[model samples]
Target: MLDAHLVKNLPDFKIDVNIKSAKGEVIVLFGSSGSGKTTCLDMIAGLVHPDSGHIRMGENTYFSSNQKPFPAEKRNVGYVMQDYALFPHMTADRNVQYGMKSVGKSEKSLALLDQFGIRHLRNAYPHEMSGGEKQRTAIARALAAEPNLLLLDEPLSALDDKARHDALTVITDIQRDLDIPIIMVTHNWTEAEKVATSIYKIEKGRLI
Candidate 1:
C-alpha cells in the first residue's frame, strides 16, 4: 500500500492532500490544468518535494520533510510523462533499457516492447514513430525498471480515440499483472471512469 500526507506551498495556493492507495489499484486524480494534479504526482515520484508531511510505499519511506528525501531514481517509480518523453536520439528499445541495470536488460526490454505490442518498432527513433507508438514506448521504458508504482501524467491526451482505447487496455492489463499501484492524472472524466478504481478530484489544490 501507499500512504501520503503531503503539503506543498505555492504562491497562490497550497497542495495539501492525504492519499492512500492499495496495491493493484488504479487511482486517478481528476481535474483541469493548473489544478495541482501533476504536482501531486511529481511529489510522490520525488521529482518535486513536499514542504511538509511524509510518503510511505509498502516497506519504503519515499519522502519526509524532516529527513533526506529519496531521489527520483531510488524512489522505485515508473513515471510516464505528459509528452511521452522518449529520447530523440535513442531507438525505442534503447529508451526502454535506459533505466535498466540488470544483466537481463536486453531480454526485459524486448519483452516489454512485445508486451506493449510495439516490438516491430524497436529499432525506430521517437521522431519516426506515431504518437500511439511513442506512448507505448514511453510506458514500456517506464516499466523496464521494475518499479513498485506507476505514475502516468496525461498519458492518452495526445492519442486519437482508437489509440486511446487500445492504450487503456494495455495499461489495465499491466496494472493487473504487475499488482502495483498506478496513480494517473487526467482532466478527462471519461478516461478516469474507464481506468480508475479510486478517484480523487482536485480543485485549486484541494481534494474535493
Candidate 2:
C-alpha cells in the first residue's frame, strides 16, 4: 500500500492531506489550479518536503517527522511531469534507457517502446513525435526504471480529443500490468472519472 499524510505551509495557504492506495489502484487527486494537488504528488515523490507527516510504501518509510527523509533518487518513483519532460536532444530509445540500471539497456528500451506500440519511433527525437507519441515515450521511459510508484501530473492535458482517448487506454493498460499505486493529478473531472479506481476531490488545500 501507499500511505501519506502531508502538511506544508505555502506562501498563501497550508496544504494538509492524507491519502492511501492499495497496489494495482489508480488514485486521482481531482482538483482545480492551486488546489495543492501537485504539491501532494511532489511531497510523495520526494521532490518537496512536508512540514510534518509521513509517507510510506508498504513497509518502507519514505518520510517521517522524526526520522531523516529518504533521498529522491532512492525513492524508485516514476514521475511523468506536466510537460512530459523528455530530453529534446535524446531519441525515444535513449530517453527510455536514461534511468535504466539493467544490462542490455538498448534491448530493454526497444522492448518497452514495442510494448507502448512506438517501436518505430525509437530513433525519433521529442520534436519529431506528436503529443501522443511523446506521452507514450515519457511513460515508457518512466516504466523503464521499474519504479514502485508512479506519479502523473496533468498527463493528458497536452493531447487533443483522439490523443487523449488513446492515452487513457494506455494508462489503463499500465495500471493493469504494473499493479502499482498510481497517483495522478488532473483538474478535469471527466478524465479523473475515466481513469481513477478511487478519487479524492481537493479544494483550496485540503480534500473536500
Candidate 3:
C-alpha cells in the first residue's frame, strides 16, 4: 500500500491530508488552482517536506516526523510534471535515457519509446515534437528508472481536446500495465472521472 498523512504550513495556507492506496490504484487529486492538489503529490514524491505525519510505501517508511525523509531520487518515484520537463537540448531518446544508469542506454531508450509508441520520434528534440509526443517521452523517461510509484501533475492541461484524449488513453494503459500506485493531480473532472480509481478533492488545504 501507499499510505501517507501530511501536514504543512505555508505563508498563506496550511495542508493536512491523509491518503492511502493499494498497488495498481489510480488516485486523482482534483481541485482548482492553488488548492494544494499539486502539493499533495509533491509530498508523496519527496519533492516537498511535510511538517508532520508519515509516508509508507508497502514495507518501506519513506517519511516520518521522527525520522529523516528519503530524498526525492531515493524514493523511487516517477514524476511527470505539467511541462513534461523534457531536456530541451537532448533528443527524445537521450531525454528518456537520462535517468538510466546501466549500459545500452540507447537501446533501452529506443525500447521504451517503442513501448510508448513514439519510436519514430526518438531523434527529435523536445522543440521538434508535438504535445502528445513530448508527454510520451516524459513518461518513458520517468519509467526508465523503474520506479515504485508514479506521480502526474496536470498532465493533460496543456493539450488540445484530441491530444488530451489520446494522452489519457496512454496514461490509462500505463496504469494498467504497471502494477504500481499512480497519483495524479488535475482540475479536469472529465479526466478524473475517466482515469481515477478513487478521487479526492482538495479545498482550503484539506481533502474534501
Candidate 4:
C-alpha cells in the first residue's frame, strides 16, 4: 500500500491532502489547474519535500518531517510527466533503456516497446513520433525501471480521442499486470471516471 499525507505551503495556497492506495488500484486526483494535484505527486515521488506529514509505501518511508528525506533517485518511482518528457535526441528504445536497472536493457526495452505496440518506432526519436507514440514511449520508459509505485500526471491530456481511448486501455492493462499503486492527476472528468478505481476531488489545495 501507498500512504501519504502531504503538506506544502505554496504562494497561493497550502497543499494539505492525504492519499492512500493499495496495489492494483488506480487513484486519481481530480482537480482544476493550480489545485495542487501535481504537487502531491511531486512530494510522493520525492521530487518535492513536504513541510510536514509522511510518505510511506509498504515498509519504506519516503519522507517524514522528523526524519531525513529519502533521495529521489533511490525511490524507484516511475513518473510519466504531463508533457511525456521524452528525450528529444534519444530513440524510443534508448529512452526506455535509460531508466532500466536490470541486465539485458536493450532486450527489455524492446519487449516493452512491443508490449505497447510501438516496436516499429523503437528507432525513432521523439520528434519523429506522433503525440500518442511519444506518450507510449514515455510510459514504457517509466515502467522499464520496475518501480514500486507509479505516478502519472495528465497522461492522456495531449492525445486525440482515439489515442486517448487506446492509452486508457493501456494504462488499465499496465495496472492489472504490475499490481502496483498508481496515482494519476487529471482535470478531465470523463478520463477520471474511466480510469480511477477511486477518485479524490481537490479544490485550491484541499481534498473535497
Candidate 5:
C-alpha cells in the first residue's frame, strides 16, 4: 500500500493529507490549481520530505521521523511529470533505454515501447513526435522498470481534445497491463472518471 500522512507548510498554504492506495487501484487526486495535488505527489515519491509523518509503501518505509528517509532514486516509484521531460537530444529509443539501463531491463524495454504504440518512433527524437506521442514515450520509459507505484502529474494537461482522448486510452491500457497502484493528479474531472478507480480530492492541502 502507498500510505502517507504528511504535513508541510508552504508559503501562503499548508499541506496535510492522508492517502492510502494499493495495487490494482488507480487513485485520482482531483482539485483545482495550487490545491497541493502535485505537492502531495512529490511527497509520496520521496522527492520532497514532509515536515512530519510516516510514508509507508508496502514493505518499504519511504519516510519516517524515526528512520532514514528514502532518497528519490530509491523510492521504487515511477513519476511522469507534466512536461513529459524527455531529453531533446536523445531519440525515443534512447530515452526508453535510459530507464531500462537503470534497472537492467534493456531486453524488455522495446516490448514496452511496442506496447505503448511508439516502437516505430523509437529512432525518432522527442522533437519529431507529436506532444501526445512524447508523453506516451515518457510513460513507457517510466514503466520500463516496472515500478511498484506510478505517479503522474497532469500528464495530459498539454494535449488538445483529440490528443487527450487518445492519451486516455493509452493510460487506461497501461493500467490494465500493470498491477501496480497509480496516482494521477489532475484538475480534469473527466480524466479522473475515465482513468481512475477511486477518486481522492485535496483542498487547501487536506483530502476532503
Candidate 6:
C-alpha cells in the first residue's frame, strides 16, 4: 500500500497530491508534460523530498515530517524512468543486475526476464538491442530488487507505436506476477489503458 499527501512549493508553481494505492493494484497517473505526476512518483521513490506531509509503503512509514527521512537507497522502491536508463556499455543481463539490492542472478530474476521475453537478449548490449528490448531490460532491473512499490514514469514514451504496445504487454505481466502496487506516470491515455487497473488524472498539480 502507498499513501502520500505531499506539498512542494516551487518558484513557478506548487505541487500537492493526496493519493493511495492498495496491494496488487496498478494505478496509472495521466497528466501533461509539466504536471507533477513524475514529481509525485519521485517523492514516493524517495528521490524527491516533500516539504511537508507523509509517505507510507505498506505498514512502513518511509517519510513523515515528524520523523527521519528515509534515504533513497533504503526505500527499496523499483523505478523505471522515461529514458529507460540502461547503461550503454553493459550487456542487458549485467545492466539488470547493476545496483540491485537483491544479490545474485537468482532463479527469480531470470524468471522475470523470461516473462518479459528478454531472456535471449541477456548477452546483448543496450546499443545492440532494439528500443523495446532495452525497455524490457530496464523493467527487469527494477523488478529484480522485489521492491515494495514499483514506479514507472513514461517508460515507453520514447518507443514507437509498435514498441509501446509491446512494452504494455510486459508491464501488464509484471503487475500481475509481482502483485505489488504500481504507480505509473504517463501522458498517453491509450498506453495507460493497456497497462493500468485504475486511472488517476492530474491537472494543475491536483488529482482531477
Clashes of each: 0, 0, 0, 0, 0, 0
Candidates by lDDT, descending order: 2, 4, 1, 3, 5, 6
TM-score of 2: 0.98
Model 1 gets an lDDT of: 0.92
Looking at candidate 4, the ten consecutive residues that score lowest on lDDT are 100-109
For model 3, what is the alpha-carbon lDDT of residue 137? 91
Better of 1 and 4 by TM-score: 4
lDDT of 2: 0.94
Alpha-carbon error at 153 in model 6, in Å? 0.5
Candidate 3 residue lDDT tens string, 87-170: 999999889988898899989988999998999998899999888888889999999988889999999988888889998998
Please give the TM-score that candidate 4 achieves against the real structure: 0.98
> Which candidate number would show the highest TM-score if scored against the true structure?
4
List TM-score per model, in order: 0.98, 0.98, 0.96, 0.98, 0.94, 0.92
Full-model lDDT for every candidate:
0.92, 0.94, 0.91, 0.94, 0.87, 0.85
**For this target, which candidate reaches the highest lDDT against the unseen true structure?**
2
Pairing residues by index, what is the TM-score of model 1? 0.98
lDDT of 4 by residue, 67-173 (tens): 99999999999999999989998999999999988789988988999999999999999999988999999999999999999999999999999999999999999
* Clash pairs for candidate 1: none
True-structure RMSD for candidate 4: 0.7
